[model samples]
Each structure stands twice: as C-alpha cells, then as structure tokens.
Target: MSLTADPPSGAVPATGGTLTHNLVNSGAEKVVFKVRSSNNNEYRVKPVFGFVEPSGTTSLEITRLAGPAKEDKIVVQFAPSPADAPSASSAFNAVQPTGNVTIPISAT
Candidate 1:
C-alpha cells in the first residue's frame, strides 16, 4: 500500500481538543486502513477502520478526551483490498498484518 499521512504531527489544546490527519493513497489499488492510538484511554479515534480507493483521500479525527496532554502517536495500519473481499474492512482478515504508518501527536 502506497500511503502517507500529512502534517507529520498534530497539536491539540492541552486541556482538551481535537486533531485531524489526512491520509493520501497513491497506490494502484484500494486499501483498508485501521486507525488506532497508542493511548486509547486518553484519546478517541473515529472511523477506526475504513477503505480508500486508489488516488482517493480520507481523514481521521483524533480527539483528546482527557489527560495531561503528553505526546502520543496514532497508528494507521493498511492492507491492500482483496478482489474477493466483500468490503474493504474485511481486508483486515489478511492472514498476516502488512504495514503501518505512525503519526505523532501532542498537546499545544
């Protein structure tokens, strides 16, 4: 999967705020992306998993719920969609995990 995240990093209010990351897919095939955070207890991510068509783009919203606003990271796991898969989300059923892209997060 030829994927990348922009802004490299994100900033939110130390007290509590929301941050968003844009993911660009430049590959030739569709990809299923699973989003997660290093600290799930302190943060919430939307669209935990989804799919992106080739040359398409999608956004992930990472909102800091409550914490000291320390540095954290978001993990974006991606795998190519299988031809027979009913949906992109099912791609995660891959026999093995493929790749991941990490995005740094911090409180402003």
Candidate 2:
C-alpha cells in the first residue's frame, strides 16, 4: 500500500486538497484501503478526503482526480477491497489485475 497527498506533487494541506494510497501486487498480490474522514473542526473549515484504487505497477504514488471540495492532508489504511465485486455489506476485498494496469488516483 502507498500513501500520497494531493496536487500530485508537494504537500499542501488545505481545503479541496487530497491524499492517495496505491495498492500493488507483490507476493500477496492483493490489497485494500481504509480511509477515515478527517472531518474535524479544523478539517470542517477545510473539508477534503477521498481514495482511489491503484491499477498500475509503476512507481507507487497518489494524486487527485476531478471533483469539487479538494483535500490536502489525509490519513490512510491498507487491507483489501475485493477480487470480485461484492455487496458493500460483505467483508472488504480487492483483486490485483493479472497484468500491468495503471490506476490513476485522485480525490473523488
């Protein structure tokens, strides 16, 4: 799992900013992410937090996608999303693509 901040570059914790985590296949070959809302009084003034599934094998990194209300700083957790699409109520799981796929990440 990888942790990343918005602007796809330097660190800038402000409103409408972003943080990203990349999950690539290794020996495990699968991973998941858990994001906690930074929606505190401080963040309330500048609310922003989101995540995206990494789909490539390039150097791991996190960047932001197109959306309203960007996030700057973000806390991230890694686990598994799912190999197959399952119900939201089911346990978390994520599938690692068989080949190279670059999953661009952003705050959506």
At residue 39, candidate 1 shows an lDDT of 85
| Model 2, backbone clash pairs (residues 3+ apart or across chains), number | 21
Q: How close is candidate 1 to the true structure, as a TM-score?
A: 0.89
Which clashing pairs does model 1 show? none
Q: Write the per-residue lDDT of candidate 1 for residues 1-108, one digit (tens) a residue.
A: 688888778888777888878888998888888887888888898888777789998988888876785888999888887767775566666625478889988875
Q: How much lDDT does each candidate structure score?
A: 0.81, 0.35
RMSD of each: 1.6, 9.9
- Alpha-carbon deviation at 9 in model 2, angstroms: 9.0
TM-scores across all candidates?
0.89, 0.32
- What is the per-residue lDDT of model 2 for residues 1-108, given as tens digits with 9 covering 90 to 100? 443333343332333444333334343333344333343333221212212345433233333333344434434444444556444224233433222222222233
Error of 2 at 7 (Å): 9.4
